[model samples]
Target: MSNNPMNMMFAWMKIASSYNQMMLSSSEVIVRRTMMMASGTMTLPDAMSMMMEKGTIYATATERAAVAMASGADPAKITAAALKPYSTKTQSNVRKLRG
Candidate 1:
């Protein structure tokens, strides 16, 4: 990421947008999964798989953030790194669920 203030601001804006998108996708996933469960299409193992996937995703993001902080990354870079996995996963989930 550029060190320019304007560029940093844009980066933050992008991150914020990504965060909102992730949240929206997450909500959609939850609702869809609930509906699936209600209709007996989603089983306990499927729900457990979703939970495990979430845990893995969170752990990966946390590890990335920790590594970035240990390396003395700038605040914006650290946040961007942390958000990357979440953004990628949620975007993927959105597409998969839509299909």
Candidate 2:
């Protein structure tokens, strides 16, 4: 039942649809949980802490992916390669942002 390119596309589409639904459900959960905190004995600091926890989880996951991608390079080599054009481009971006 898996002998065609069209079938592969359909399979991937099904996976993507499920993934999107999961993301929507997760956002709905955050909205619901935060709503109760907004009216309860929770302080602003507590809400911020929850938000920060979610942000850090995503940040660390992204960092881990980047590390995995860079795993083939030695640390010093990777640092030098990244810095070669990145530093100048970052400065250019900062100037563009300021303007």
Candidate 3:
């Protein structure tokens, strides 16, 4: 209801800040869950690789969600975008695996 452009800007900034906080908390939860899910069968290097890949996926989702929300996009769309990066097909490994 605020007609002042500055007020609207501040309001959006608040929303962005809140989104960032939530994203960070969610990312922590994600990392914790990933660690918990790693069984004793995995090697140290393999576990670290899995953790790093999952963390990157989590981070990318949050970053995209923040950008979408800051751009005045629909919140539902933002949430969906955050969930989008979870698919394994979206991930890429920079390190080449030589058998």
**Which numbered prediction scores highest in lDDT against the true structure?**
1
lDDT of candidate 3 at residue 10, scale 0 to 100 = 67
* Candidate 3 displacement at residue 75 in angstroms: 1.7
Best by TM-score: 1
Error of 3 at 88 (Å): 4.1
Cα deviation of 87, candidate 2, in Å = 32
Model 1 misplaced regions, further than 4 Å: 1-3
lDDT of 3 at 97: 22
After best superposition, candidate 1 residue 95: deviation in angstroms?
2.1
Query: What would you estimate as the lDDT of candidate 1?
Result: 0.86
Instruction: State the weakest 10-residue window (summed lDDT) of model 1.
Output: 89-98
- Each prediction's whole-model lDDT (CA): 0.86, 0.51, 0.59
- What TM-score would every model get versus the actual structure? 0.85, 0.39, 0.43
lDDT of 3 by residue, 1-99 (tens): 245677666656765665665566556545554554674444678568756876788789889899989988665557656765653222222112211
Backbone clashes in model 2: 0
lDDT of 2 at 27: 59
